[model samples]
Target: MLKLMSLEIRKHKLTGLIKGVLIANLIILGFMVLVLFVDQNEQVSTFTSFGDVFEGLFVFVKAVFIIFASALLGRLVIEEYRSNTISLLFMYPIPRKKLLTAKLIIVFLFTFCTIIISDLVLGALLFWINHFLQIIPGQLTWILVKDELVKLGTGALYAAGIGLIPLYFGMRKKSISATIISSVVLVTLISGGFDQARLGNFAAISISLGLIGIAIAYVSIRKIETDDIT
Candidate 1:
């Protein structure tokens, strides 16, 4: 598994994937800053704890991470099939399932780590700015800190897991465009539901989507064995 994952990492080294991830993070940071400026009054009036600020940040993070996963899946999976490079990979001694598993694991880990880091960095930066600027009114108590940490960890996992749905779509269709487009549509619909339902919590919804992504991944791995490479 380590060897396969290493190989997968090397494959993506020159693919601009890392660059893209960095650019995405920067964009998110900029957007967060803009929101802080525009919603200063609202945040000051409504937010009572760190969790409140984290929740708002998470909404954007979740959406951006989903799109990031779709792009990675396109380059790593769909592009391979589209370019007929997967046939070349099949000629290797490695089992197709293991190869695919390595790729998926990389995707999950990459997405998971990126989200976690981004969340931490942005959360801290925002908190620091708030300390002096008083943009968001909240006390960073131990309880609030612990709760936000748990949320951040679980939220990253949820984003990574939900990403597999687009991976499954890309693998099934071998279409990069389909993978990206479907991901956008899925996130939009899910976000819309949350907006309308006013559930005020995304734990249940995220978990449900994560489960669906797992099921789709299982189907993808099973089908790959007999899937036509021609």
Candidate 2:
């Protein structure tokens, strides 16, 4: 499992996805910082713990990540399915279960790790800017840091979690475009109703749903009859 994951991570670099996540956080944080900094509104916070800023940032990226995850996993599946690659792999006397497990673990952890890195960078950058002008008081303001981190972490996981659903769809469709669009539509419906409200317990539910989706995908892939194997 470790070797398989290491191989995929090395190939993809995961940096591109991390960059996407960071850019999204900053762009949205920019507007919020502007509003608070310019207007001097103490009540108006820069952190979008649950509102549109939180959810909105993922609006486009949500689907994009889904496609990425799907591609990350599906590419191998497709390779095995369409190109007769699985035979070489299967003939090695390696258990097919191990192969499937490795792929699923890599796909799941890759998404989680990307989110962790991106959120850490984003939270650091925004807090730096906020503290520079005393907007966020000082570096020792652990409360602000903690709050923001919690929100960002939660938001990120929620996204990465639900984001995997698209991979399943992508695997089914095997079409990049379809996976992308479908991912967007799914996120819209999931995160739509709780808009402008604190994610609260629903965030937990989202995480659960994400894990469930991943589990189902893993099992499905265990029996997946792809002819190619990357």
lDDT of 1 at 112: 90
Model 2: per-residue Cα lDDT at residue 86: 59
TM per candidate: 0.90, 0.65
Question: lDDT per residue, candidate 1, 1-230, as tens digits?
Answer: 98998887788773567677778778887777677667765734434456767777776777788888888888888889888999999989988999888888887887798888878888898888787878676577888878888988887887788888887667666889889998998777665544336332556878888788878877787778888789
Query: Stretches of candidate 1 above 4 Å error?
Result: 41-49, 193-202
* Best-matching candidate per TM-score: 1
Alpha-carbon RMSD, candidate 1: 2.4
lDDT of 2 at 169: 62
After superposition on all C-alphas, the RMSD of every candidate to the true structure, in Å, is 2.4, 5.2
Against the hidden true structure, what lDDT does model 2 obtain?
0.57
- Model 2 CA lDDT for position 129: 71
Please provide, for model 2 over 46-146, each residue's C-alpha lDDT reduced to its tens digit, 9 standing for 90 to 100. 43332333233343334445445666655554445445565766776667667666766666665666665645554455556755665543234467556
